[model samples]
Target: MNRGLRIAVVLAGGLAALMLAGCGKHETAQATAVPAPAMKPAPPTPIEVKKEEVGGPTWDPEWDKIVELALPPAMLSGQVPHDVKRFCPAFYGMAEDDKRAFWAYFFQALAGAEAGLEPTVQAKHAQPEMAVKDEVTGRPGRTSGLLQLTYEDQKRYGCDFDWERDKQLKVGDPDRTILQPKNNLECGVKILDKQIIEKHKALLSASGYWSTLRPGTVSYRVFAKQMTNVPAACAVHNARKTVDGTR
Candidate 1:
């Protein structure tokens, strides 16, 4: 009887060990399992922020954020912003072969100061425009586009792009002809040319016109210090219109 009891005890111990082993295996499997990472679009490469001091309206953090989103390194290059057909229509229209390159660089730098190459920028807080009717929905819209052209500029340039004519508008719905890249650029270039090339009012007006370029102003100092490319930009500005003044 004692021998039988010993055998039964051994059997029970073996069963317990088997149960524990099974549990260990289950735990191991659970521990090792992992979920796969979810798929997402690769984010755009980041541009380093220029940290410099300048005086003007208090810096809006939003402008930096907006610029980072819109302006890529490629867009800021003189080649891209200086292009004759696509980006800078102003360059193409320049009759003077002598100043074309300088003009392109000047405009590129100005773009950095303005909308950061964002064609659709509205300058919502600064320059308000006449509320024009949208031809499709009859909804009222205001000034927007590349160069942030204002309602005054639209009328000034005599740009009338009826939405009905453009089936392939960039935003899918036409904002207006003034807000379109081509129209806004045409107006903006003509104004720029008239200001410098035609009127010869001096390029200083360009720097003075935009607070960002005004010297000794907080914005100017900030741009000078912060924007790594300021020297290149200044070189272009000075080369083109130094007698007019520069930051």
Candidate 2:
């Protein structure tokens, strides 16, 4: 080939190599421009309990701490009962720690009304409907514990109460799973979750598991009084549907 033709061929090959390098650089720049995916927020810390609302011959102040630790992660999540936010709008804006504190207060109030915060108190009902026999003990069905749960709750709500082992122990024994404050309160959370979240029942429905949560019942009055002192962060100013009974 002629010299001019040789020079033209070399220049063309060099230009092609530069064009390929430019395309490679463009691809690398595009890859580096992508943004990272967003991260989910961290879960809330455990609640710190300070006091109780109920005092009785059987009430134990230590049960308050058990209620605090017994609360599950879901309870502190956004899935909290709408009635709570409806009655206390401030609950929507409160920090995770404050929300946890409010729920701890709520259970304390409930235990106060249901069993006077008595972890081992057993109550028997004479009303024909509620006077059923205890399936585990073959005796009359009686509500027991800080939340007044029965051995049947183990089947109904998958509670941790073990009557077979507990029967060997004397009554009011702290070793009884039903009488343990943490077990009783955790089971209470599960029951309330099913009622309000799964069953879509009102928090204060007459058909609720606990009569203390049912509005207009004499026991509900006791629960209402305890709610009067919910965490200040709740900002429950108006008489909406609350322990104060706007609900």
Candidate 3:
């Protein structure tokens, strides 16, 4: 009877050891089968801000914020020395809200879309005059100053002050009203405003102006093409209607 009891006790101990070993194996298998969680991507860095000159209105912090959004790095890099007050007196007439809105439109949005607020003058006749007359009409190619404002545009735009004769200047002299940032901006705005008002079309919408210009492969078209989105800056002015009812 004592021998029988000893054998039974040994059998019980063996069974308990087997059960523990099986439990350990199950835990290891479960750990290996389970998957790890995925990591998330990092966010992009913000653009750095710097102090620079711009022509239009006095530097209001609020207007500066609008400029920051509208103007690109290239425009900011080309600083204009003239005070905003010198050129854009129209800003003074506007309500505070409207003034801020116009700055965004004229300076940030339209200026960016146009040939930029700075002038680009092309001198067609840098060479000595050969005195050749045109078959269609008598005209010489030699001209200078912004917009390549041939003698024709100069007369039309009333910029008769001779930058060429006075300074023997190339492109981008401050005396050239065309090169003046505020003047350039004002001229560009006036041109667009004239077109919109005369045509009596709702020019504020992206599709509206895009359709009117019907931009081909010209340089102006290319500039407009780059500015695909309608600037949020213009919304404050909210003068979308034309003299006529065609939207």
Candidate with best TM-score: 2
lDDT of 1 by residue, 1-247 (tens): 2323543554466557545655646766757754321111111111112211222222222222222222222232333323222212333233232123333334434544555545556543432322555344344544455455555553444544454544355542435565555665555555554444444443333353344455567655433433333213134344445445653
Candidate 2, residue 52: Cα displacement in angstroms equals 9.1
Q: For residues 1-247, could you state the per-residue lDDT of candidate 3 as single tens digits?
A: 2323443554465456546655746676756653311111111001001112323222122222333233322222212111322223333343444333433433333333333322444334433432343222245653332223333344444433443453466445566655554444434344444434444443333433222233343544544443333233323123333323444
Residue 100 miss distance in model 1 (angstroms): 1.3
lDDT value, candidate 3, whole model: 0.35
lDDT of 1 at 216: 64
Q: Which candidate, 2 or 3, would have the higher lDDT against the true structure? A: 2
Candidate 1 regions with alpha-carbon error over 4 angstroms: 1-98, 126-143, 159-176, 206-247
Lowest lDDT sum, 10 consecutive residues, model 1, at 38-47
Q: Kindly give the stretch of ten consecutive residues in candidate 3 with the minimal lDDT sum.
A: 41-50
- For model 1, what is the C-alpha lDDT against the true structure? 0.40
lDDT of each: 0.40, 0.68, 0.35
Residue 159 in candidate 3 has what lDDT? 33
Could you tell me the lDDT of residue 28 within candidate 1? 68
Please identify which of the two predictions, 2 or 3, would achieve the higher TM-score against the true structure: 2
Model 2: residues >4 Å from true position, as ranges? 1-65, 238-247
Best candidate (score: lDDT)? 2
